[model samples]
Structure formats: C-alpha cells, structure tokens
Target: MNINSSICNLKFGLFFHLLFLSCSNRDEVKGQIPNVLFIAIDDMLPVLGCYGNSTALTPNIDTLANQGILFMNAYCQVGLSNPSRASLMTGMRPDEIKVWTLKPHFREEKPNVVTLPQFYKEKGYATRAVGKIYHDGAYHQDPVSWSNPSVLSVTRDGRGHKYVLPENYMPKRSKATTTENANVQDTAYIDGKVCQAAIELLNQLTDSTFFLAVGFRRPHLPFSAPKKYWDLYEREMFKKELKNPRRPARAPDFAFHNSNELRGYEDIGELGVIREEKQLELLHGYFASVSYIDAQIGKLIAELKRLGRYDNTIIVLYSDNGFHLGDFGLWGKTTNYEASVNIPLIFCGKGIEQGAINRSMVELIDIYPTLIDLTHGEMKSSHDGISLLPILKGKSSKVKSYALSQIVRPYQDAINSRSPDSMGYSLRTEKYRYIEWRNTKNMSVFARELYRMDDALSEKENIASDIKNEALMNQFSDIVNRIRK
Candidate 1:
C-alpha cells in the first residue's frame, strides 16, 4: 500500500470513531431522561390517608405518598380550574397569561407560549394526555401539547333518571340530588375510561421517553361514584364539624359565596347553606368518590408496574385545586381561603427522595421548572415559580417564603348580590394569611383580612380591623401591593 493512501485511511477511521463516540454520548443522555407520569385530580382537597384524613380511603395515593415526597404546604396559584391549570401548565401566573376566568383560552392571550407537555415534546419526548388535563371543555384542550391527539371522556355521572326523580331530572344538571351512588362498575364512569386509555398507552409505549398525563375527574361536583364506594362509608360514620358556620369576622362579604356551584343542580333549589343532614350525605358521597378515584389511580400504577416502567418514571400526583366541602358556608372553590388553595402534591420515582414530607410553601407553577430541571430541558419562556429540585433532593427546605393565590369576582349583581365586582389577592406565609379585596374597576383596596396561622380559627377570624396587628398587616399589604403592580 502507498504511504499516502495509508495515512488518508487512518485519518478517515479516526474521524468515524470520534463521530460514533459523540453520537453514543448523546444517546446516553437521551436515555437517562426519565419518563414522567403526571396524575391530576380535580377539586381534590388535601384529604387523604397520607395527609392524615382517616375517613379518606385512598390506599393507592397513600402508597404513592409513602414512596415519595409529600408536599404538605403546596398550593395552587388560583382556586378555579381553568386559571389554576393554565398557570401550572404554562408555568406562568394568571396575570401573565391573562386567563383569570373560564371563558378565555390561555392561547388566545398568549398564542406562542409553550406549555409543560409541549416543552417536553420539544425536548424529543412523546407527550400524551388522557382525560381532563386541561379544563373539561373542548376549547380548553391544547392541540400543540401532544404528539398524538389528546383523548378525553365524558365527565357526566351518566346515571340519568336512575338516581334522580323523573320530574326533576335534568340529566347532568339535576339539583334535586347531588350525591349519586350508582350500582355499577367502575368502568361505567368517565374516570374509569381515562384509566383504561392510560393503561393502553402505557402498554403501547416503547423505545421512547414519554410524558403521559392522566387526569381524573372525580370528587369534584355532584359527588357521583359507584355504590360500592358509598358502601365503604356509613352515613352515621360521617361527622359534620362546622354546621352553619358564619362568615369570617371583619372579612369582606365578597370573600363568602352562596355555594353557587353546588346549587347549580336542578334538584338543588335556591342558594343557601346546605342543611346538616344533607351535608353528611354529601360528605359521604365526596369521600366515596375519592375512594373510587383512588381505585382508578391504583389501576394506573399497577399498569405502570406491570410494564416495568414504575422505577424509571417520575410520578407526580397533584390536584388542580382544593375544595371547600361546606367550609365557611361555602360548598365550592373560588376563594383565597386555605380550603380552596391548599392542594395535595406528591412526587415519586426516579431522582426524588422517598418518604420525605416537605412543609415549605410551594406553588403549582413550580411544577414546570421542577420538571425542566429534572430532565435538563431548556426553558424558552419566563416562569413565575422557582424550581423545587433542591427541595426534592433534600438540598434545601424552602424555595419561596410566601405562596400567593388570587381570585376575581366579575360584576355579577344578579348571581351574587353581596359579592360585587372585586379581586381577592391572598398571600400565605409560614405564620400568617393576608388577603386584600380590591375593586376590579378602579383597583382600589375594598377590604382586607389578616389571620395568624397559629390560631385554630385562622381563616374564621379576620384580624385586618384589629389595631394591635397594624404593623403586621402593613407588612403583608406591602408584599401584596408590590406583587400587584
């Protein structure tokens, strides 16, 4: 062989070897990115066995909590479904996205903003959503967020006249009865269908990293579940803690509502405080629905395990927002109160500490940055929430000292005569909850509420009018004002 030819061949061989090594390293990094299993529940409060709710029969969720870090102080940015979901998915606050109400789609305001799943999809991960990841409506679904088309099921109870009186029957909107204990299988409900779809996707996933979001719609409204779940709890076993509780002292009338969401059913008449006897039945149905959803979650987790994807998947289970369950004479969300904001957040699987309970304040928007940090994905847009990766790894105890939540009450004089057009901005620190109700039109402070966290009736007592806590109230007001601008 000629010496020149041999030299050229050696150089070509060395170049190919270097190229192979670079490609191999890239593949290794891609393989190391763990799969994400995001489970979202609607209108779920922090009432679970792991969260110390003895009445909550959530063995699957409790098991997940035991195997993960249960965030004790995690809260939603807003209490409403569309606003809260949009905030977390976009990693932006409601103000930034301009999505404070259910009417406006987030994309309509920020058309180019990338969502959490879309971000993962951009990072070469296959993203799919089954069930109620976004709001339950068709307009709420984002087509750009998934690799394939998103799958959604009917959210109605589907019992029809079987559970309600024929005269008062309105299919999905009968107010005559709120709780339906249908004698049917779990698959008869929408959540069950969601589970089945998720399981099918899990079985089909191979040779690719994925972001599978399974959102369960249960324990939300109407409190419908299988009769077996209701059979798990006795009506006598359900205890009513606060019957006909008065509005918070010194709290603005705008802070309380007539449980309008609960009264939407045809069977339910005019808006009023639910009677104690009926409250027990509703509570039983809520718990029963929770248990039913827990069973569905168990099925999903079992499928992941069966597919050998449990260990390598990053499992995140959280709720969209908290529910009132008749707190403060309110039966729905949309207030800045703890019952509406505090949600259950659990992180399990790869790259997370197990059995760790974090009490530090965290927001739902933080989920976006946390997942980005975990997968080493790049962020193309700004985010209001800080990453909780340090807290998840036990490197830090707290990310932010305060978590903020807000709600806007539109001009609805006919619907809610007492709650005029106002905006409720609440800030929660480790020791206090400060709320400011501002006029929506003029942006002037209408009323204020201050509650010490150490008090048993912190939310029940509004110390904004107390002269003794004037300094503390000023400090909180300053914080809220700074953020407001």
Candidate 2:
C-alpha cells in the first residue's frame, strides 16, 4: 500500500490527459455564446423516475432528463464532499491534488490550478455560484474562482438550518428529530432560498451569456422539507423490508464507512443501533426531501423558460456523490460500493442530443471539459479530463472504458487529524465493480472484491474468490497496475 508511489504512477496518465485538454480544437460560436446552467445537488443518487426508482417522486428531474441525454453510469472521484467536489471542479483526480481528506484545500496542492468556473470566467463568461459549490468553507471555497461573491452559509457540522419548526431548531431537549415534515412554505429551508437566489441571478443575466451555478443542499441530512412533499409517498412504502439491509456477503469490513455522518444527529439516538420503524421514517424523509428539491428545480426551469434562456442555455444537472439508504447497512456515502459512487448525470439544452440514454461509464471530472466543448469548443487549459464531445454528439458510445473512484478508510472522524492506514481504489466497468484494498505503506493489494453490477442487488455479494472469475480479476488488475506504471 505504498500510496505515495501510486500517486507518482498516477502522474503518467495525468501528463497525457493534460496535453489532451490543452489542445485548441473548438468551433467558435457564430452568435450569442450558449449560457451554462450548472445545477449541483448534494448527496443525490439516481432515484428518480427516469433512473427507474419507483418509490421516489421526482417529475422535474425526470422531465429534464427527457429533454436531453441521461448518463446511466456516472461516478465521482471521491466519496467525501470536499475531496469529491475538489476533484470534479478542478477536472483532476484526488491523487493529483493530494486532497485525500477534507482539510488542505485542493488549491493548497496546486495553487494556480484554474477551476471549471474560473476557467470560464477567464474566457469572459459571467460565472457566479449560490449554495454548496465547493464545500462552503473559508479554506475549501476558492475566492479567486468566482467572478462575483458567491452566496453560501451552511453549518458544515450538520447541526443547524436543518429544521423549520421552532420546536425543532436547536431544542433544549435531547436532539432534534432526524426529519421534520413542517407545514411551511418552501422558502423556510435553505434550499428554497438558494433556488430563489438563482432565479433572481438568472433574471439579471438573461441579457448576457453567464455561467450560473445553482447548488441545492437537501436530501443530504436531517431530511427536512415542506409537508406537501412529504405527503407524496405513503408511510407504508418504506415499511416493506428494505432489500440488502446488510453488508455484501464476504466483503471486507474496510470496504464500508463508519456512517458517523448519519448517526451524529441527535434524534437519531444511539449511534450504534436504529430501530426498523425509525429507519422507515428516515427513508420517507429522504424521498420527501428529494421531491422538495425537485419542486425547486421546476421553479428554476420555469424561470429559465420565462426568461427565454432555456433554449440557448446548457443545463447540466449532477451530484457530487451518491448516497446509501440502508444499502449494505450503510446510511451515507464514504465507501467504494455502487450506492456510494453511482450518480445521476443529465446534460440538456443547446448542442445536447434529445431523449437519448447513454450507458457509457463517465466521471464527474469530465464535466468541466464537456461544457467547454459544447458552448465554444474546449480551450487549451491545465485540466486533466477529456472532452466528452464524441459521446454527446452520438459519434461514440463511450469516452472511457471504466470509471475510477478511490477513498481512504478510517478517515471519517476529522477534527482529531487522523490519517488512513489503507487506500482503496475501485474500477467500475459496464459489467463489474472491482476493488483492491491495498496497504498504503507497501502498495500491495491485501483484499479484493468483485460485483456483477448487472442489477440492483447484483452487489449483494462478492464473487472475486471464485476460480471461474480469475481471468476477469487479472484483466481488471492489469488496468489498475498500468496506471501505477
């Protein structure tokens, strides 16, 4: 697990990709340049009607998916918020930025690395952001990346701004309820205000070609939303036994996160054990929060259409990372499992194909260059992601063979300033999600797991130990080894 050596090996691929990103191969727009509407949803997985989640009510996202291409196998570079967004916004992997943990912002590693938005700003696009774009911390949010002051004020510890009811807001009682179906307007929550702010910004920028990033913070924790959204699903829906409520069969313990993020809330009570009935409540809250965010998106979409920017603007909706709703007995994202890495990526409006489904493997990092390619031809830059013009143009089925995601285990509880003993790297292909847990000191693979990834429950067990799959295992191993060389 000599992680440092692996980091050095990653540079080989990084070097070539950097060259590819800096090439001038874009076609200049003939008229008004296409505006970019970047919508980022926190902790959102592909649980909408378009993604085939029967229980979740998300008409706005489903409708947006119908307007363009929906990528079925999109992934994030890391599971944690700060690291995941850092890698994506910079169009680089976590290893290249040396940001394995939340602290020491990506800029600390590469001081002058131009972010996705910053690159657009340099190109004369009015880039502005609202809500959780880059972790919302003084250290994590790079001030130089924005053309105007961004609006973001979140209680990073998952404590406040989660409840609308006065009784639930930092109550003197033990802990606040994990969910609040409050009878209040949408503006009572932070996400509602964020959506409003974005709409106002859009109104002002309708006359110009602006890159507006509207980020919504919901369905992440405390699952608080308007009661109307909560009424969308009946309580009986979550009571049915959740499929695979336990870890994968024979999967290593290191492969799962501690889930301290979910357990930290007060009403959750007992960090170790949660009752089945309570789990159902949490599930209901998650669905309702998703619906709540969907409503906000509906409003944003309507505003865009009203302003006449819908036709000429490119709306790219994606999440930093996927969440686990009792999958593998894991409640949150911080693992290499399918539920943690698989995200919903939809590209719509202006230069994007209509009503098509792309089953190719793509990463969050590819988005930076994809926008550049669609709007004004991608420019020469320091990014490490390849432009996805081929896939979007329907010329190629896929841009990459597999998606890569990695995480450092035993690094969840920060503030103590702890380091990981092992690093896990997982390669996701069309057929399988393979992982190798290696020693960070020696760079030797200590444990391995392989999932068929054919269906939802295909990851319920690991099949790498079977001799029949040894050839498949070696083939995946070679891909991982090649990156190190």
Candidate 3:
C-alpha cells in the first residue's frame, strides 16, 4: 500500500473502533458509502435504443438510460483498448501513462500510479473486478488494483472462450471464424459466464461496500453471440448502403488504417476491399453481439434488484472505445474519427438526476473523480480528469468545450512505442470534429481535418484548409497546440 492508502486505512480503523464501542455495526459507516458497479463493454458505439437508434435491440440498456444521466457526447482519451482502458482507469492521459499500445502493461510505465479501483480499495471498499476490466492479457492486468482476487476472463471465466461452435474454431487454420451463433445456453460463451460469475460475486459482497467491475466482452471483433440474439433482428436490416464509405477528402494517408485487426480471422485475410455481402454479415454479427450483451446486463441488474442493492449502488456503464462497422471502409477502432472515439456513457444510481440527457462533452478519464466525489471520499492523489459530480447533480449544463480523443498513426495492434511518425489530436465539439495531425519528430503540423458533423457522418469532407475557414483553422491549431502541451 502507498502512504495515502495507509493513512486512510488508519483513519478508517479508528472510526470503526469508535463505532463498535458505541454498539454500532460497521453497516452504519459502510451503508453510507454507495457500492459501485462499473460496467464496461468492449467495442460498443452510442447506437443504442436509448441513444435514439431504433435498430438496436437493447431494451435493458434503454431502461437503464431512463433511470440515469446519459451523456450524448462522451468519448475516450484514446481509441484503442490498452491505451484507452489505462487512461480511464488511472484518470490520466495516454501520454502521461505512456501506454499507447496493447503491450507493456500500464504498470510498466506508471508502476505505482493508483487506479480507480485502487482508489476505492484504499478507502475501505472491497474492489473486485469480473471479466475483461483491464486489457485482455494477464501481463496487462493489475492485481494490486483489487482488494481481493479478481475473477478475470483472461484466466478462464470469460475472456478466454471466444466461440461456441466447434466449426468456427479451426486449429488447422490457426484462427477462428469471424462470427458464430450457437443454440446453446448463454453460459456456453464468454460474456454469459462472465455475467454468471458477477452475479455470484454480488451474492458474496453483501457484507462489504464493494466496487464491482463487470466487464462484458461483446460487440467486439469475431462478433459471436447466442443464436437467439441473432434471431431478434433480420439480417437484411444490416444490408444498407452507406453515404460515405471512404476516407474523408483531403485527410492524410496516415490518418486511416488497413482494417488489419479484422483480417486476422480465417475468412478475411489481407483483403484490401471488403465485399459488400461480407460487410452485411459482419454488421449483423455486431448487432447480435450487442443484444446478447444487453441480455446479460438485464440479468445482472435483476440480480442487483433481487439482492436489494440496486438503489444503493452506483451503476456506471461505458465502452472503452467506439467501433467502426464498415464506416469509412474501416472495420475496427484505433482511429481519431468520431465513429471510433465518441462512445456511450451512462451514470445511474442514488443522488444522480434520473432520465436526464446531457449534450455536453465529457471524457472517460472523468469517471475516477466523479465516482470518488459521489461516494463522498477524499481524493488524495492528482489526476488529469475533473469530476462530473456537478453534472450528475444537474448543477451545470456543460463543463468542457470538447471531449478530446487522439490516435497515433501508422497504427498497429502492438504499437511501435518508439515515437510515432505522426499523431492526431481530435477535439470533438458540439457541431464539429477538428483534428491536427502533428509530425512526431519535430511536432510540426503535417495535416489537418475539420468535419461538420451536425447532421451527417464526418467522413464526407475535410474543411480544415477550406479558404472560407481560414480563421477557424487558425483557432483550431491554437487549441490543439495548447492541449498537446
């Protein structure tokens, strides 16, 4: 434990001792501190039933939105899993964490940096994580963040199992098929078993004030889900033509990737152009996976209500990054575009204004301080994010001008930790998404893009250098330079 954690524990012990002498159970102190149920979905965008998407079959998530504050314009600091998760969990920027890739865990960069869960655990909360909370690998997972042994999918609970159908998993091919649907129970796959374990953990956490992180791995790549979820929607629904199916005009070549993440599967292999028919199949799979995750969330919430902990627990649901399903001819995340950065963020619990939708922008980094402030705990350490507590209470309409999200170009799953060729700083504002691509070596402006995303997809045009917007381009440059420093 660090010095701050030691001091908090000392104070808690003294308070508990005095309460015990007065014949008061620990519940008096613990009950006042709300339990935290942090839910993380893998690669989900804001296209949910609550987010005004009629196509998605996310009734459970929609119901939760009816009882919470929904952030219509929330985003991640980084558009990749490792960097994004590390940034949000630590309340730090990707540059501060020095974790811009899928390898060399966050601890490798900031070893003793207290994570969000560690923050709660330091203040006498039983912080436990279930499923894919951190990243996928065991090396990237942090055990010190939890107060007890975490039920991680990386070990066997959920993250390891990918496919339900034997044919989908071909050892002869060295990779599984991209999508699958089995007529088996939900527990046959990863997310179902993860939810089952989380429900079981909830039963055991009755005595302690807990920060339980239930991470659902669905709507991700190789989009696998139960057959019933696939049956909920007609596959033809996903076979629609897109308005802008290519990269934005005037955008640099380095700004876009080869959609290589999806190519690792058996079917898609280094194919430069994805067939239209295959794109529909992938979209259908993605939607099915989302509904499957929603079902699991419904079950978990039912368990919370059954245990009578629903009202006292703060439920935070968010995705680490938004996904691109054939948008701009991209099939995955790791982009600074709005489709890959703008994500769904909902806060539902006691003291939160219910059914309120906020258009103001916020970052995932703010989750750390927001939760601490809600629980009335002392925040001893410094972090890059500010608390959204006031917004949660409806005291303010806006707190940030833009939710910043960035990406390093020449993108690769295992990032080239050595300074990249270029880095794009994207500022997502109310009506526009402004990007400034800087040369990494000398930090010189190499490219720029400004997309007016009020009524259409952002990839239609890049207006940064448009002659009419000369003054606006100069202002955007100054904003990027100030934030980059």
Candidate 4:
C-alpha cells in the first residue's frame, strides 16, 4: 500500500509539469502574432524627407521611418495605378494578370487568386479599408475581407469642419464646372475623410485583431490645393531654372514622349493650350498638395498612438505608384522611366529594425508575401514574388540585383503615331537603366540606353557607342526573355 501511494504522487507531479509546458507553448504562439496597419498614398513620388528630398514637408512619414526600415530603392512593377496596385495585392506581375489598363477589374481578370487582405482575414484579422485602396475609386474592396468598405472624399465626409477654396482656383478652361463644392482644400482632401473613418473603425473594435488599410488621394491631377498650401512654395522660385531637358539618345523616343491626354490638347485650337506661367502654377500646387497630405498623416499617426496600438501594429506606408513631376519634359505617368517606376516603401512595426535603409531592388509584388510571412498567415497559393521578410529584418543581405518595368499603352499604339503599336520593356539596376521598345507585331525597335545614376540627375546618355560596354545590351535582352517567360 505505501509503494502504490508513492507511485501515484510521482504520476501527478509529471502531469502538472506537462500542463505548465502546454500553457507556455500556447502563450508563445499568441505573442508572436502581430496586427497590421497598411497605408497607401496615391500618385506620390519619393519626394519626402526620408528619401533625401529636403523640400518635402513629410514629418509624419519621416518619424515612421525613424522607427522602421525604409526601402530606399523600392519600385513598382508598373507605374500606372491599376497594374501597380493589382500586382502588389495579388503577388503577380502585371503581365501575368494581363492587367495593363485601368478599366478591367482585378478579380475579373484573376478570379481564383488570394489577395493579401484575404489571407489576413483567413488568419482571423478583421480587415477593413477606407478611401482609394484600389485605383480610380471604381474597384471595390473584396467583400469577404473588408467590412464598411468605402472610397470617400473629405469634401463630402459630412464632418463638422468647413472647407473653402479660392474663387480663382478652378482652371479657366476646365470642362468641370466650377461650383461652391467642386474644389476641396488640400488639407481637406479625401485622405482626411479616410483617416476619420479609420478612427471610427478602431473605436468600435473588440477582441478581434484588425487589418486596416488607409488610402490617401491627393496631388494626382489638376493640382488642386488650398491657398495656405500654395503659400508654402513661391512661383518665382520655379522661374529661375527654366531650361530644355534632354534625354538619353539611345533610349527609345517613347521614353521622352508624353501621354495622349497631354497631346490631345494640341488639336483644341488654342483653347486648351497651357501657358508656361500656368504650368509653373500647377507645379506649385503639386508641392502644396504633398505638404497637405503630410499634415493629414500627422493626424492619423496621433490617433494610432492614442489608441495604444502604435507599438503592436505593423505600419507599412507605400505609394500605389510613383508620379512624373515633369521629368524629361514629360508631364505625366505613361512611360517606363525611373521617375515613374520608383516609389517609397517603409515598414515599421514588431520585429522591424529601425533606421535601416535597404538599397536592394524590391518590387510592389513582394509586399503580399512579406505581409503573410510577418503575420504567420497561411500562404494561399504560389506567388511569383518571394517574401521580403528576411530583407526587412536585415537577416538576408539582398533582395534582387535587377528589376523590370513595362508599358502597354493602347492609345499610343494607334496607327501612324511616332511609337505606333508601342510596347516597351525596361530593366533597372543599382547603377544603370536600360530599355527596348517593341510594337504589337513583335518587331524589335531596340534602343539601348545607359545612364549612370551617380552622375547628376541620370541624364539619358547614349553609351551604346562605347565598345567597352557592349555586354549591358545583352544583359537587358536576357532580362526581357526571363520576364516574358
């Protein structure tokens, strides 16, 4: 009887120890999961304090960078809105989805694909989005993942604050009617509305983890901003350096060509002709719009801190795509230029190393896998992009040495144009940029361009003449072959 009692006591001791170990294991797994707060800016270039653009007033983004890893060389798969956003969400290249234009819906093209937000939702996150998370305000958020999905503009937010625009703010020849409500102050743009909605969503949260996407729309077109923002930059400052900008001779003519929207004004019989002073005014307005967006970001960041979710939430800020601020004498995004492709991407949150600037070549497509890996969410399907987790943590040394971009402008491909039937492919590296154009019929209108970015402003110089550098052309061709496959 004494021996049996002693054995029973030993068995109970082992049982208690095993129970403790099981509890500890569950706690460990729970602690590893993280919340995500993804922010997107529309048509914004890397003209921020973090990206070495001293003139940009982006205090909120700069502060975010101070606490996270800022990708200095991050680029989009394509420059346009639909393709760039689609590629990032689905982990597929634009060509893979056949989404080169703004009109086709993403889900319609790739019906069975699993989006980043959908993956997070499957992992028990209550995913929500406000404002232009996708392009053109027409693409709705996936209903399965997003609750209270909307793309709202601040002017119509029904908020208490009164927004006012100057009487002369409207363009003299704009087709849009100038009304009391037509022009919204830059500080009062759609992003402010989105931020308010996000605050409301967070306020109602409970035990469930959240995935919130806040999209800001400003500084894209028409260059509309409040009078105060316009006061930030002087028009006289822009008048000092007017000169004819030249591009690389070896680069295709399409590289320097403006979009059809700009060229359509030529046949309007001087009615829509934009004067030089007017162009400078537009430039000033763009700068003001950027500053206005920065101020709105300041508001959102404060709200996050107030909720006590600042430390635990993974904050990622990225532009849907980069914009062309009159580079190469071009006014807008439709070309495969570096200015149009390169975007600013910053990640700050749990396990993200602070103040680290990664110069490795990374694309928007990588964002999908990176988020999955960070959250330990289930991988839905095979993706063309690998996770940027190792690179973000400073664990992996490099992401990629080369990046590719493409252009498929149907309007520009019409018959008898300078670049008739145009489709071009570009390759970018740490030190150089190269491109080759092809028509719809598959004719090689090959133009070899080489630019040394270390030089001032990366002026397009035709280095094809230099016999010593013949290997670069072959390298570009090989990249095209791989991308096509």
CA shift of 330, model 2, Å: 1.5
**Residue 454 of model 1: what lDDT?**
53
TM-score of each: 0.89, 0.89, 0.91, 0.81
Q: Each model's C-alpha lDDT?
A: 0.82, 0.81, 0.84, 0.68
Q: Which ten residues in a row have the lowest lDDT in candidate 3?
A: 152-161
Candidate 2 least-lDDT 10 residues: 22-31
- What residue pairs clash in candidate 1, if any at all? 174-266, 174-267, 175-265, 175-266, 175-267, 175-268, 176-266, 176-267, 176-268
Residue pairs of candidate 2 with colliding backbone atoms = 1-439, 1-440, 1-441, 1-442, 1-443, 1-444, 2-442, 2-443
lDDT of 2: 0.81
Between prediction 1 and prediction 3, the one with superior TM-score is 3
Residue 126 lDDT in model 3?
A: 92
What candidate 1 gets wrong by more than 4 Å, as runs, is 1-31, 153-176, 240-244, 377-381, 410-420
TM-score of 3: 0.91
Candidate numbers sorted by lDDT from highest down:
3, 1, 2, 4
Query: Candidate 3 at residue 172, lDDT?
Result: 47
Q: State each candidate's clash count.
A: 9, 8, 0, 1
Instruction: Report how far residue 353 has shifted in candidate 4, in Å.
Output: 0.8
User: Which lDDT tens digits does candidate 4 get at residues 143-235?
Assistant: 654644553522322221222344323434332211123234433645556677777877765344778888877666645555666677677
